[model samples]
Target: MEASPTLKEQVSILEEQVGTYETVKSSLIEIEEESDVTEEDFSGITFYSDASVKLYDIDSAYINQLLGTYAIVRMSEKN
Candidate 1:
């Protein structure tokens, strides 16, 4: 017969997952901060998710510039 995980074991697993999630989330935030990408709540902007947000085709140069901020920020970077 297969033994099921105990409650404590389950909790430990969940806690580990939570810890990993926190690390990943903080890493993402750090990446954003380091890149100087100022992303305000998109909810406020009119046509933010509707008309303004492009899906498939985006400007490669702009994206590259945004990513480049991760290397060198402040000198030539903006939100």
Candidate 2:
């Protein structure tokens, strides 16, 4: 049988969310603010000379939980 993830493993996964946020936050392209995201953007979108923005498929609810975007539950998926 497969083993469940240990506490250390779970913590590592949680830590990765912070790294992901920082990486995107520091990027020059402000995806939603600068350009409209299309279905293609979800695959891979490029801008200007060299920046490429690809939307990775992570669960929106998980992201909301990680970022703590609300007082209770997720506000909306409209973003």
Candidate 3:
């Protein structure tokens, strides 16, 4: 059996996967300016942004939540 990653480890891995940290940060700031999300709304949430984003092995419920919140311009499956 394999052990699951800790929350900190998951966050670190997500950060590495989303290399454009500054770009994502700026985009989040812009989103905050345009939307009703406050700093408290962002607590314990991770933001990943890129020109062409790819998310692997994510939970369907979480994906649906993201889609509900943000506009996904493009998406495709690979398997």
Q: Pick the candidate with the highest TM-score.
A: 1
Q: What C-alpha lDDT does candidate 2 achieve relative to the native structure?
A: 0.70
Consecutive 10-residue window with the lowest summed lDDT within model 1: 29-38
TM-score of each: 0.24, 0.20, 0.19
lDDT of each: 0.74, 0.70, 0.70
The clash count of every prediction, one per candidate, is: 0, 0, 0
lDDT per residue, candidate 3, 29-78, as tens digits?
A: 64325666655655679777794687689899998988865554433322
RMSD of each: 16.9, 22.3, 21.5
Candidate 3's clash total is 0
Question: Using lDDT as the measure, which candidate wins?
Answer: 1
Task: Give the per-residue lDDT digits (tens) of candidate 1, residues 21-76.
Answer: 88888888633235566767778665545777667877999899888876577655
**Candidate 3: segments with Cα more than 4 A from true spot:** 1-55, 71-79
Check candidate 2 and list the clashing pairs. Answer: none
Error of 1 at 71 (Å): 46
Q: Which stretches of candidate 2 lie over 4 Å from their true place?
A: 1-5, 28-79
